[model samples]
Every structure is written in C-alpha cells, then in structure tokens.
Target: MSDTPTEKPSNRPSPVIVLVAPQMGENIGMVARAMANFGLSELRLVAPRDGWPNDKATAAASRATHVVEAAAVFDDLRAAIADLNFVFATTARERDGFKPVRGPVEAARTLRAQAAGGYRAGILFGREKFGLDNDEISLADEIVTFPVDPAYASLNVAQAVLLMAYEWRKAGLERETDIPFTGPQTVAAPKEELHGLFGHLEAALDTRGYFRPLAKKAKMVDKVRAVLTRPGFTMGEIKVLRGIVSSLDYFSPKEPRGAGYPLRKAEVDKQAHPARRAEDAGEGSDD
Candidate 1:
C-alpha cells in the first residue's frame, strides 16, 4: 500500500464543526486536519483568541488548506449556530442541565438523522484551556461527552475533535471501505435503499399500531428511523430486513400461510457471508 494520504471529499450533509473561542492557532489547524481526515469540510470559528486569518493555524493544517481557507469566522457562538436546527456541545466536565447527554457514537447517529431530515446541525468545541462554560453548554440542545477516565477527563482540543470526527465518519462508512477485508457481494445500501427501508418499516409499524398517540407519531417515527439508519446496513442486509418485516406483517406462522416472504434477490446462506460470521465471533473485542 502507498503511504500517501487521500480523499479530497465531496460536499455532503455533514455537521458543521464549530470551534468556540479557541486559544491556539496551531491547535485550530490540527482540528481542521482532523476534520479533513474524516471527510468533514465545514469549519466555523467563533471569536478565536488570536483573532481570524491566523497564519499559524493555516500552516499547521498541512494539506487541509481547503478546510482552513473555507473556514467561516463568526463573532460569537449564537451567531455561529443561529442557522443550525440542532447543536451538540462537547465538554468533559459534568454540569447541571436538562439537555440530553450522549456518547460520540450516539451523537453521530443523531447528527446523521438530523442531516437526513434536511436540518442543519453543528457541534461546539470549547477553548483549549477550559472546555465550554456552563452558559455556552446551555446554548446547545445536547451534550456529547467522551468516555474517558473520570480521574483525568480533560483532552486536547484536537484530540477531542478527532474523536468526534472519527465517530462521525465511522457511522457513515458502515463497512463500505477502509478495511483489511470485506464480505462477498458487499454492496453499501444507497440512500435510496435506506429511504425505501424507512418507508417500508414505517408502513408496517403503522399497521400494527406501533406508533402510539397521534400527536407524537412523527417524533416517534423519526427516532425509529434514526435507529434503523444508524447501522451501515448492506444491500443484502436491507433485503433481509424488508423480508423479515414483510413476514411479520403479512404472514401468520401459526396459521396456514403457504410460504414466507421472498426477497427480491436470492438469499445467501451462512457460507456466503464469512466476513459477517467472523464479525459476529469478534463482537465485543473492541468494546
């Protein structure tokens, strides 16, 4: 394998990474590099201490000049997030708040759902010295705290940003590439297939009265869709899911149903998916 880096990523519906009151210009560059590494290009700077047009940050960004050059400088956090429909604040310190707290993975999933719903979202990263203040954190609708040791919870601004960026990319890759091995007939379920899956499952659930209370049905469906779309399900996996849903909704196992639901494509058995079987055996190793 070549040692060169790549991926001049295209524009996508990704969360805007907002750095709030960053202190060091070099750290800002490093954060930008981290974002670039993870295919995130939208960068927002809010009242950096050294001010805008920092040469040090741009120099530190290495090849991520595009992200640095396109970065938007905002006077304040409110103005920075004014156009965003949802926001997540990253902080290590525990504080009193009614907002929901989640890990990076869950936050990434929520961000993806928000993007799918055509809503802009952003994540706030605080100053390198002391994380986001109580007031700043309060501005965010949700909190994303890293699962670090409680005794030493603090992380460098770049490190914190890198963690979130990695999770965000991982949530999307879903075994598409960047792996040592891949399963046979590994086809990433395209956005259309995912949307189709959502429509199918939602319709099935509706017939079973799964959505309770008419007023909250939309919100409930949104949450369910988020969970379903969280996994990078393959095309085969999507077919299996649709087939399972069809069987449950239409066929009666106890009664005299002639046959179970048939998938559009022929089903592959255990022998056809050795990679998945390997993954199943290796579950919890990373945890």
Candidate 2:
C-alpha cells in the first residue's frame, strides 16, 4: 500500500443557502461570513431587500468575499431549490404545522447525515423582518428553529446560520449510531425496508380494527401508505415499528390465559351480549 495519508471523507453538503427577501446588506454579508466559518461556500439570493453584490455586504463578509462574489441570484425560492434533493428552512415563529420543526443542533446533525448519502441539501433563511412565509416554509422538507428564552426569542439571521453550520460540522466527527437515518456516513433506508415497514404498519392497524367500514378499507390503506412513504421512513424506524407489532401480538390474548384474562372476559361478555341473554335461553344453551 502506498504510504500516502488516505484522504479523509468530506461530509459537507452542497449547502446552498437560500435567503428569501433578506433585509439589510450587512446581514447578508454576515451570513456569508458565518458560512465561511463553517466551510460552506455557496449562497443563493432570492430577492433580497438591499440588492445583491452590495458593497456593504462585501465589507461585512470581510475575507470571505469569495462566497459573496460566487453568490447566485434567483427570482424566487422554488428556483433556488429546484435541483436540490433536500431543503431545510430556518424560522423563529411557529406556523401551524406548516413543516416539521427541529432544533438547530438536530437539524444540522440531520443535514450532515443526509449529505453523507450524497444528497444536495440546502439551508434556507428567510427575510429578516417577517421570516419565511407559509408558502416558503411549505417548500422545505423540514424547518429548523433555535431554542431561546420564550420571553425573548430573537435571533439574527447570521446567528441562526452559524449555529446550524457549527452543529453540522460537529456531527461529521461523531461516532456511528444504530439509527440508519442519523449517522454521518449512512444512507437513507432502502426501498425494501420501507415496504416492509408499510406492511407491518398495515398489519398492526388491521389487528386494531383501524381499517373498519369495509367500504373505506382500500382508500384508507392507500392514504396511510402515502403518508408513511412521503417522509421516506428509515431502516431504524422500520425495525422499531416491527418490534411494536411483535409486542402487541404477544399481549393480544385470544383465549383468555394471562393476567388480563378476567378483564378480557368481562369485555367480551358485555360486547357479545348487552342483555342478560334471557335466563331460560342461557340455561338451555349451556346444557
């Protein structure tokens, strides 16, 4: 073997930051600075307030002018994320379940893990004043939020970017985990694992009579399958849910033979016969 030191693998994403209608040229520059601090080099401007290629931004970006000079301008958010495999947004206020919100550290961890799978992921920061609008949030796979004091939860755009970038960098150096979706070098769950998870979920639901009303059975199953497949469930989650099926099946008593046997009998009696079963008929039936 050649004694050359093996090149360490790079965990960095393409990491195009989409700033949607950002205010203040200095803030944009500061964002560039933060990006450089964490080894990120791409910036995409989506209709900035002060205009791109601004001198103020260059001054703030300081020695990181390479990021500023290489910045790309877009008319809207959709164009910015068109070619990316995964997109994440940073927002402060809650937007009524518009997207799944994760803390900064966790979101960064997720980004690095996803990037290891060779995805082109982008982190989007919205306008300074109103932040990302509902339409913009909907464009992202997940939204990342910072944990601040409830009474005073104000974080500047640059600060949020710095925090996310720092966490992502840290995650790249951590040990591997059993969670296939969460390790720096692991890929997303394969199609087979996902299919198995769906089958297990449907079986569990069937056992619980969730697919009630024969008319709606097919439609309901389709809808449920659509949802579980959307976020792209991971191998680890599939394993966990499969375990759930075994646990539920083990405890589901069919013949009344465990600690819960008497309670099960009472439930069965009530459901099977609401009335006392007419005393004369009960006596004759038993005989």
Candidate 3:
C-alpha cells in the first residue's frame, strides 16, 4: 500500500432529495443534515406543514445551512420532480405490485450511474405520521424500501433520508465498506490451508471417538466441514481455529470442563510484561 493517501473519487451532481408534505420543521432540518453528510445539497419541499423559511428548521440543521438555505418549496409533488430524469419513492410496506421496488443500496447505485450520463434523479420521502398516499407514490418511477423488521417497519422521516444518503456516498467509493480507518486486509484462506484444517480437526475428533455411530461418521464429517467452510473464513480466522484445535487436542487438564484450560505462553508473556500490551494498543487498537 502507498504511504500517501489517494484522492476520493470525483462525484457528479448528486440526486435531489425531495420531502413531500413534511409535517415537522426539525425533520426537514435533519434531512438536510443527513444530505450534507453524504455530499448531497439539493432539497425540495412540497407543501411543508408550517410553511417555508422555518426558523425551527434552521436551528435543527446543525450547520448544514447550505442545503436548508437553497431548499425550494413546491405547490405539489408533480411540479417538484417534473424536471428530474428519474424518481424514487420510499415506502415501509409492500404496496400494490405495479411499480418496481428496490432496496436503498441498489437505488443509490442506480442514481449514481445515471448521474454520470448527465441524467438527474430524485428520492421522495413522505411525512412522519402518514407516508406518501398511493396517489403521491404513483408519481415516482420506482419504489424503494428499507429491510427493517416487519413488526416495526416505520422509520423517522430524517432516518429514512439518512439511509438513502449514506448509500449514495458509498456507491461513489471503490471500497466495499467505504469506511474511514481500516486495518490490513486479510483474504479467505486458500483451499490447501482449508483442507489441512479439515484434516487436522477430523483427526482430533476421530481420536476422541466423536463419531458415535461409525456408519454415520463420514456423513457427519461432511456436514461439519460444510458448515465451517460456508462462512468463508479469512486466513487469520483459519490460524485462530487451528490454534484452538491444537490446544484442545494436546492439553488435558486434571479438572473437567468446569475448570478452564491454562493460559498460553503469549498470554503469560503479556501478564509478565504488561507494558507490551499498552505498546501493542498504541499501534492503533485494531480490535
């Protein structure tokens, strides 16, 4: 890796976030806050509850004044999004199955890809109490929903805006996680390493007569291997698992499972030279 930091990906004009018939000024302000966090600036309001130039909104914006100041108020939903090339309506529940539905991540990526071709897009968020009526959502080109618990699927107006905005910024970046700080990347263990781990674990289990019914041993081993490998463990995880297996295979304490096993040499060393642990943490606390 290079010692120098790379510049962030160049961004085109972001999607316009339109809030339809928003009830609370604070929620509108927070929507601006969420938008500014992810590099979005355009904000459109349709028949806001308490009227425009809301002082409550400006106070709640938390210094995201630019988005709030430039916000455009509209008489209705149709006129608000008339100029946009594409539009998305956010909903919590599954509606009548006419329009295509998308999740937040896919919707954001689609918006970003379209922006690159000089096309514009907008995301519509309904009010806090009652979301977009069927008539309002019908105006959007597509529907987007959050995969939240069905029992409590409703989201705060600002919270819904935050999710869409976060996904939009993530779509612009190259990293899968799109986080600020990161440790050394570890990839999935190679097949050779995985096979060795399976063999070692099976041998340990075999020695302990773990397969009660001998006829079922092979099927049981297959199941165990399949379950362990399904998660695609990284190389570091493979090492840790092998260490655990080696410990269990070799070390036999006089006490039964009630008493814990002895600490390893590394743990003893850390206890003896406590400062080493602090120095290790000073290397940036990877955990």
Candidate 4:
C-alpha cells in the first residue's frame, strides 16, 4: 500500500449541524456518521442526554471520529448558534406563528448562497421524542419542513440530518455522471440467430408432446416465444441455451409411440394429475 494518509477535503463550505436537547448517545454518533456522508463536518450539541464524551456515541460513529472529536457542546440553542449568520429550525408540525417554510432543497440552496457571501450558516434539529418547542423555533430565521406524510411526519434526528446533507451536496454539484455497467460487454444476438434458437427449442418440446390440445397449441407456442424473446439474448447466451436444449433432447429417455397414435383424454388427464388416477380406479372398482 502507498504511504499516503487519507486527507479530508476542506474546500467546500458546509453548514453547522446543531442538535437541541438530543437524547441518546447512539443518535449523536449516528448524526456524526450522516454528516460525514454528505461532507458536513461541524457538529454542535445543546444539552445532550447521558452527558458528553460518551463511549456509545464514539462507537456508533464508526469511522467518523473527526466529527465526534470536533463536536462542540453548548448549554442552550442560542449559545450553540451564536456565531452563525443564518439558522433554520426543522419541524414536522405547524406552529401558531407565521414563519417562512422551505423544503430541504430550497434550504440547501439558500445556505449555499449565504456561505458564498462569507457568512456562516447552521441548521437546528430538535429532540428525538418531542421536536423543537415553539420558543426554540422562534429563534430561527426560517422554518424547514420535510414533505412527508402528514399523519406520520416524525423523522429520526440522524435521518433528517442525512437528508439535508444530501440535498446540500447535490445542490453544489455541476453535473452527475451516468452509472457504469460492470458485467461482460456483449451485443444483442441477431434476429436470425434468435429465430433459429426458438425453432430448435420448439421442435424439441413438440417431440415430447409439450404443445397438447390442438385448439390451444397456437396460444401455448406464442406464450413460450414471448418468454424467450423478453430477455433480448446475446449471441453467446443464445449458443449456451441451444447447447442445453440439445443435451436434454439427446439424453432424455423416450418411450416408443406406435404410428397413428390417437390422442386419449384419459391419458392426458392422468399425465396432468397422476395422483387422481388411483382415486379414479378405486371409484370405478367400487361401482
């Protein structure tokens, strides 16, 4: 391995994630992980439950030690976002007072613009069980609400942080690249090759009396063709399927059928339901 140590990017401007009266240590660590995923680094906690410098939080953070280590603790919301120029409070429910509400994407764009003007921006998240109270929300410049189900709008603290972080990163992107296909590169088989394979398989099945009941033979054949044509098989795939059909045709045991063999209904029913034959024979003997 190379001797170079992994370096974190410091070029982009990221918003400060403020957790107000957060309850669990695990949630703090998970929030750190989510922040790390979308390139957000700064973390501020206001009155976290179970105390600070928690081992559970550290463990749950996994590889996001940088976020957990640099986390700043504050006594209240105002102290946590004292230096920020703009603050957004996330809430699921509507409050009594009128406040400008923005979705995650809009909030991200606004934060980006504010940061470009050399001003620090932060987002406030509430407690897990009860979200931000009316008093705490009044401190924010704008309200941010997720467009989720009205009946069940509550989101986990870490999940809310992740969604906002993802939007922030996405809004900053110039363009996105198409997903690369990793499997073997093969072109679709020619029409002639596909037709030959279909004919070969159908011929083998016909010899085994698979297309029964002359009236339904056309429909059954069409269904079989539909299944085979759905995948748009490649030349290599078609060859493999042809080989499998050839092997089955050669190795399968075939009973000799006399010339001009009549199609019997009883034989067809017995083949369809083998167990019913015994019951039918017993009933016939009883009669």
Candidate 5:
C-alpha cells in the first residue's frame, strides 16, 4: 500500500465569523485562534471597542495570524453582514418576535447546505457583557441559542464562535476517519491469556493477603477481575503488566511482621489522622 494519503477538498464554503461591537483585543485574537482550529476563515469586525489592527489581538492569536491580519472592520451590524445571503445571530436570551431559532448543530447544517448551493453565509457574535441589542439581533436571518444552564446562560464571545464553527465543520463529515495512533499494531489478547493473567495476579495478591476480611475475599476478587477485564488488554500490555508485577514482587522491601501489617497501618492512618503520617515522614526526610 502507498504511504502517502490522498487529500479531499471540501465543496462547501466556510461561514464567515462576524463580531458586533466587540470590546477586547484579546477576545478577537482568541476568536481567530478558535476559527483556525476548526478550519474556518474570514473575520468581520463591527465597531470594535479597542479598534482594528490591535497588537494585543495579534499577540493572543499566536499562530493564527492570517485570520487576524485579514480581518475586515465595518461601521455597523448591517454593513458587516451586508454581503452575506444567510446569517445567524448567537444569543442566550429570548427575543420578542417570531424569528426562527436554531441550535449550533442545526444552524451549521443549514449553513453548509446554503453554502454548497453557492450562497454566502455568516454567524454573528454579540458583545461580551450585554450581548447584541434587539435591533442587532433582528437584522440576522435566525437566532442561535446554546443548550446551557438557564441560571447562568452567558458564554464568552470567542467561546460562542468556537462552538458554532466546530459544529459547522462537524456537519460536513460523513464519518470520523482521521484519528491517529502510535506504536506497533496488535490485536486484543485472547481469553485464555487474560484468564492466566487474572489467575497470576490473584495468586500473588493471595500471598500478600490483599483480599482482607476473609468473608469479602470472593467479592473483592470479582471486583478486581471486573476492572482488569474491562480494558481488553492486548498481549503486549498483558506481558508488560506481568513483568511489572514480577519486578515489584522481587524488589519490594520486606516488612518484619507481615505483608498485610503495613497495609493495615496505612488504612488506619488514612481513616483516622491523614496528616499525622505526612508529618512523621517529613520529619525524617532530608528534603
């Protein structure tokens, strides 16, 4: 098989991110970073409080300089989205009119569909503190609300833009096929090998008296088996863990009384006076 993977180009045009009366330079930069993260470009600023070409914004954007440098500034909301055929206004509060409302997912889907059909689209983000006024929201084609806690529904301007942009990118994928992995490939361990590991661990723990209160031994063993089995450990992982257990067993310092005595003391210390042990240890340590 060829080592080089094929590149697929998207047919849909990315939605423009428009900020209405944004107050902070840092926030705009963060918005640019979020846009870059999800592959969306084209930034439009409407009457920014700190003005355009802000140094703070450029500094905060870090590697997303293209989005920051190419950002366009406009005088008002209407002028900001004038060239776009479809626009979505993000809001946390309810509006007075019967304007159609959509969540980020639905809005992204519609935006993608519209963009594919050769229509320009954009999403409007309001100010940080009070958000967009009624008139500003009314100018957009639809209102977008996040499914958030009603008691505290506010989201930062950059964060709101990130959510919408992320959804828009996610809507275009037919399947998730770009996940990365490292190390040599191996199949999961066979059931017999897993059973052997369980038995080996149980035998070692039995010698160490790990299952306390004799009556609860069976239940504890079951719980231990359940945890070990859930991960579906591969043969490589199983061998590594077995080797670790063996090395631990070989190198472990011996207690004078018994293996279980130190464990019992630790449990008692944890339940009774947690800080007492730490203080005792600190007194003897050179550091």
Candidate 6:
C-alpha cells in the first residue's frame, strides 16, 4: 500500500468501479485495492481475460480482501453497466466520436454530484492494452481521463483506476455537498409504458406503410427500440410520442387490405417516407 493517508469518506455514495475486458488478474486486484482504499465497496468485472478469482489477484489485494471477496463478475460490459444510471468510461486516448471528456477532478465532481441527485454512477476501465472499444464507450454517458506528463500519459489499468478513485474520494470529502443521487430511481419512462408506446408506434408506422419491404421491418423496428431503450425515454416524452402516433393514425387512410389484414408494404412506405408523400402531394409552396 502507498503510505498516503486516505481521509474517511463521507456517507456519500461511492461511484461503482467497472472493469471491462481487463487483461490481467494483478490489475484487477490492484483496482480492487484502489477502490477499497477510497471506501468504495462495489467492484464489477466484465469478461476478464484471465479467469476471475485467481490466486494471483488475491495475493495482490493483500489488505483489501473485502473488495476481492465481494467483487462481482459479469459476462458482458452492458450487463455490468445495466444498474448504473450515470456511467463514465476512462481512457488515455481520445475516442473518434464525440463524448464529453473530463479530467479526474471534473469527472469526480460530476459523478459525485450526479450521485447526490439520486443516481448510481459508474466509471468503466477497459483493458490495459487497447482501452475501451467504441461500442463499449457508447454505453457511457461521459469519458474521464487523468492528466499525466502529456509525453508519457499512458497509464496502466490499475494506475488509471487508482488516480480516478483518489480524485473522486478527495473531491467528495473536500466539497461537503448535501446532494447525492440516492438509490436507483432515474425518471426514465417505465418499461411497461415504453413497451406500450412502442406498440403504438409500430401500429402507427404500419398504417403509414413505413415498414415496407417485408423482410426489413423486424430488423428496422429492433434497431429503433434498441436506440430508444439505451437513452431511456421519459414518461412525458412517451406520452407525447403516443399522441403523435395517434394523430398520425387518425389522419392516415386505411389500406384496402381487409380491416383485420396485417399491414402491407405500401401502407408502411407511406408512413415511413412522409417526405416522399409530401413531395407527391405537391403541398403549395417551396420552403
């Protein structure tokens, strides 16, 4: 253990430590030690390279046995992050796509602040060699990195996690704020409600012939659901969307297929490609 004295953490909720596709057992143990040092108890491992609970790891976490004992293993990154309301991924290199990147301090502030708001926030640490993949980064709400000597900024997995944990704990102690995201209770639309809204959307789209080319309908709808499910829509937005669907259904003329006949290509096409319909209708003036 480093000789540094870690301050007693407040009752504030500690951010979850998630290892995504970590390569080494030693690194995993070190990450557990880091979390334990800062009063963080939850440790989640996602598809580790070396099988988990290895003796080498237990030896590494000499004093932080509790962290090792309580660590949870996950088959995939998404499952590991399922419970986290706010998630941040840690990486040394900037990923290609746009995602808010914050230094350890900024990330600590954001995570702690979000936790104060009643959400459980998690920080994802990827493999030592490649770091987080683009698909894994997509799971995070933000990205966090530590500032080292720019010329030599490459940090190993354990070191990176330690730095982040240290900064986060320090910030939580120094800024005595009243906010902490309580247990999991994000205001996202309930699953049942969202499912109902999806049904309405499918029905509405069917009326408009949006799902044409029979073979593609299922795949397209699945993609739509996947995208919408990831962000977690809110009740109000779901209701609004349902209302829009209803209005579209009201205005849409029924297809000639028997009243009970399943929706067909043309109807789906009309609803899906409204732009084409408007073009065909020749609605008065050009924008």
lDDT (C-alpha, whole model) for all candidates: 0.85, 0.78, 0.87, 0.86, 0.85, 0.80
Cα lDDT tens digits for candidate 1, 1-287: 22333332434589999999999999999999999988899999999999888999999999998899999999989999999999999999878868899999999889878877889999999988888988989899999999999999989999998999987886765342454344455557898998999999888777666676768999999999889877889988999999999988787554233333332332344347777666667854666
Off by over 4 Å in 5: 1-8, 176-186, 198-228, 244-287
RMSD, each candidate, Å?
Answer: 22.0, 17.9, 15.7, 6.4, 9.9, 22.8
Error of 3 at 148 (Å): 0.3
Q: Model 2 off-target regions past 4 Å? A: 1-8, 174-287
lDDT of 2 by residue, 56-139 (tens): 999999899999999999888889889999999888788788568899778876787677788889998887777888888888
- The digit string of per-residue lDDT tens for model 6 on 1-287 reads 22343344456578889988878888778888888877788889998788877777888887987888888999998899897899999888878759888989899889878877888999998888888889999989998887788798788888888888877777765333323333445599779999998888887766566776769999989987887788787898888888887886777455542244445887778779988777778864486
Identify the superior model by TM-score, candidate 5 or candidate 6: 5
**By summed lDDT, which 10 consecutive residues of candidate 5 come out lowest?**
1-10
Q: Is candidate 1 or candidate 5 better by TM-score?
A: 5
TM per candidate comes to 0.59, 0.57, 0.62, 0.77, 0.74, 0.57
**Which of the predicted structures, 1 or 6, would earn the higher lDDT when compared with the native?**
1
Q: How accurate is candidate 4 locally (lDDT)?
A: 0.86
Report the error of model 4 at residue 235, Å: 2.6
For residues 1-287, could you state the per-residue lDDT of candidate 5 as single tens digits? 12322223566678999999999999999999999988888999999999889999999998998999999999988888888999888899999857999998899889988987899998999899999889888888999999999999999998998899888777766532332234555689999999988888887787677878879999999999999999889998999989877876667666532366465766767658757766766854658
User: Candidate 3: which stretches are off by over 4 Å?
Assistant: 1-8, 183-287
Whole-model alpha-carbon lDDT for candidate 2? 0.78
Task: Judging by lDDT against the true structure, name the best candidate.
Answer: 3
The residue pairs in collision within model 4 are none
- Would you give me the overall lDDT of model 6? 0.80
